[model samples]
Target: MRRSFAFKCTLLVIGWLLVAIAAVQIPARTFWPAAFVALTLPVALGLNLAAALYWLLRNWRVAALPALVAVLTWPHFQRGLAVHPLHLAGAAPKATAGQRVRVLSANVRIFNVYPQLREKDPASPDKMIRWVASNPADVICLQEFYNEPRPSRHDGRLFQSVDRIGEQTGRQVFLSRTLTNSIGAEFGMAIFSRFPIVRRGTITFDKLTQNHAMFADLRLPSGDTIRVFNFHLQSMSMDEKDIVDSYSSKAGLKAKGLGLLRRFKRGMVARSVQMDTLMRRFEKSPYPLLLCADLNDLPYSYSYDQLADHFQNAWATVGTGVGSTYNGALPFVRIDNQFVGPQWVVDDFRVHYEVPYSDHFPTTAEYRLK
Candidate 1:
């Protein structure tokens, strides 16, 4: 009787694990699916451990259920393991000094505007600016670059202080978009170049939202024109409404029994449309491109795979160590990236986590023309 009871309980846990694993594929816009999957992944492992204990206790055949649960959680297991900075060693061809260009891309998170968040340290802006001053990169691409507005009553200039960065570094600065209109202050994307910017243009994506790519034609000291593309992609949105309505919610269970099917179908359709639009624009660029941005996706994800079809990941070339670029409270994901084309060889790459002005750490790379 004791053995039978233990076996039944183990089987029940295995069923629960299956339900959780399937939630990821379900069509719901809420946070519940991801939350539940995150929670249950570990619980599934614990249940598997319990099954092993039961096997030792009574030699029951039910131990296989927990082992099966572990297998089902393999995707999450891979995600956790693949978060490091991948260095593509031996990928870049040799080049002389003038044939190489060093570029740096950083999403400075509007200079720590969301200070309440875990990653935005108070000293981050100053540290990053100082670092930029010292580094003297040939081409610097900045997302969340800020320009000060008019003086406020309490503070003379809010972000105006950032303008001094380019002046101090002796690099020409160009803004891609403005974040605020007050005092004519704006923050968006900006490029600082030690060499002359021969030409620059912007590409905008139309998806009921404003997402853009900024391109700069850099005339290198060697007189070669290399086009650099910098962009930030559409975020997952993952709004509060989505979180509350997700499959892990109590409401999710109620919906599962009701007309929840329609809601999930709509959500999936919308997500697919957004991804398709983003990919189309990426496919049309007409240069030997060196693209950098906060891609907001992982290496093994569909977004990464699609982008990799046209460009090589620079971090995989020369980056060493845990190259995770997001320095938020969790500190696990590597959403920031650098992707290059066949025209250039990646020489070295680094993720600057010590300077935390933004939610993301800055990623820099050295490249040589092939």
Candidate 2:
């Protein structure tokens, strides 16, 4: 009798969880503001599936509840996982002549500038720079790109990463600084392109955060101009202890948990405002737009819903699987993305996971302007 009561109680709790998971899909954060809870939709969906299986094994009629919830939430799962019709061999569409332009977006975590990460691999900065140079995408959008003017023995003269990238890839470099000290040394977002930069500027967020977005108008070989918006939206900015490892004590854990929760709430509110501002700005853009960024928010939230609903997700149209770009301790999250307007066709899209130096992986998308 005790076991029967426990089983029924567990089933009831699972039913409520299933309802909560399905409800957040509507993106009404004002009504249901636990954005961080919505981030665990994938985990919730998986749990529902497991519960369905368990109930089926017990020959229980209540199995249908969890199964139905899982099916109804399948579209959210599909966005993160690729379900091919058949296990057939295939390749991305190849570019012919001047037909396609490849774009890459990455957040390099200030090129692993922290002493702890650098201590693990002394050659990380050099390796990362080489990797970026090797990719040679037509246009590159990098967040947390740093430039220190101090002379380095290896590179000599000045520690100009932007110039080095331009030298290696032969692209016009445009940078926008969110913060700068009395000295010229600074860190910010950057855009590098093979084509001429007709115009470039920054989109200032009124939020007090150091992060910002910028746009560059590049004139293509065919004389058509396209504006590329490189955004690094409001970050959760969780403490390093919350990220690198678990807290040791109960108090430390609780404090860290509360800190993260507070940051998540602040980030969500700031991001909502940022998204609204960007959409309004984009509405006036005269050229075709390609938006690339590390949107710290997940795809299930209001911010992502608004962006995905308006722009074309390069991955949804061409790439497969979760295409997860975040490679740090946090697993199975695709925070990096590329969204294009209707004036372009996504020939290919992929998350480059092989490069392990940064906390986030680089994402690339090949496009053909229509």
Candidate 3:
């Protein structure tokens, strides 16, 4: 009778855990559900081991419940680690110095007003501009390149500012026109190169948000023609009403649950579409490619996986320590990245967080042609 009671208790515990796991998905908060699933898998496996040990001592069939939990959760654990830092490190190829190119990638946040950083101080843009001027890079890519819409004193000259800086450093600047008419000005992606650009063009993706990829064909000192593709992917902006309704106190559990499901499905579908479009562009490029962007997806995500199949992450090769690039108060991940083709060798990589010119920190990688 006591053995039967223990078996019931063990089954009850396992069921409880399973319910909690399902609940995480039901609310459809992608990051949280994914994280919860990841963390619980290991614990479930450890519990199974303990149960097996206890079962050997007391001869109870209840031990199978924990083992079943382990079997069920193992996939989730592996999937979580699929996007971990270690995997990123392992995927990078070794570096060589002969064909070295130093490159910088930064999202200037469209020069938007960020109150968190004291924008009134002259030091804000000055520091960022100074870094760009001084950094010894062969190529520099800037996203969210803003120009004043009207002929205002602070507007039309944005590109000139970058160009002048590049000229001072002997780097030629190539800016792509993504948004011909944005609210503040015309904005897009820009590339400044120390090497002469042989060709350049823009690749557009169908996204729920306005995003684009800019390409530059750079002729290396080694006589190799390499293409650099810089891009910004779709954002997570939902309708204002939808956001309010999902999170508001008046939203009941069922309503919130359904809302979350719809949102998650929408985001997933949108990202898939964007990735497909970008991948096609990458496929069409003839030259050896070096791609950089704010992917907006986590390292272990499907988007990252698809890109990894084609390009090697520069950070995983040469970067050391936690390379988080977002500068928000709660920043905890490296969403910014530089990916090079198999023929490139990355010698050094860095995340520039101290330069507070934008919400996203700049990333730099030194690479050599093989």
lDDT for each of the candidates?
0.63, 0.75, 0.66
| Total backbone collisions, model 3 | 5
**Candidate 1 residue-wise lDDT at 263:** 47
| Order of candidate numbers by lDDT, starting with the best | 2, 3, 1
Model 3, C-alpha of 361: deviation from truth (Å): 0.9
> Higher-lDDT candidate among 1 and 2?
2
- After superposing candidate 1, which stretches have Cα over 4 Å from the reference? 1-98, 114-121, 149-158, 207-210, 239-286, 320-322
Q: Give the CA lDDT, 0 to 100, for residue 183 in model 2.
A: 50
On lDDT, who's better, 1 or 3?
Answer: 3
lDDT of 3 by residue, 1-370 (tens): 9867866766665665565455333222334354334235335444555665666567745556576666676443332222345434666555545677889998877654334554555456545666777888889888876545344464344434455557678988776765565454556778889888989887676531347778899998888889998888765444435545555566544466576666655554455566777888888888888988987655544565567657877765555544778776543566788999887776667787777677789988877788
User: How high is each candidate's TM-score?
Assistant: 0.64, 0.80, 0.67
Model 1 per-residue lDDT at 23: 50
Please give the RMSD to the true structure for each candidate, in Å.
8.1, 4.3, 7.4
In candidate 2, stretches whose alpha carbon ends up further than 4 angstroms from where it belongs are 1-34, 43-74, 84-88, 91-98, 149-158, 207-209, 243-255
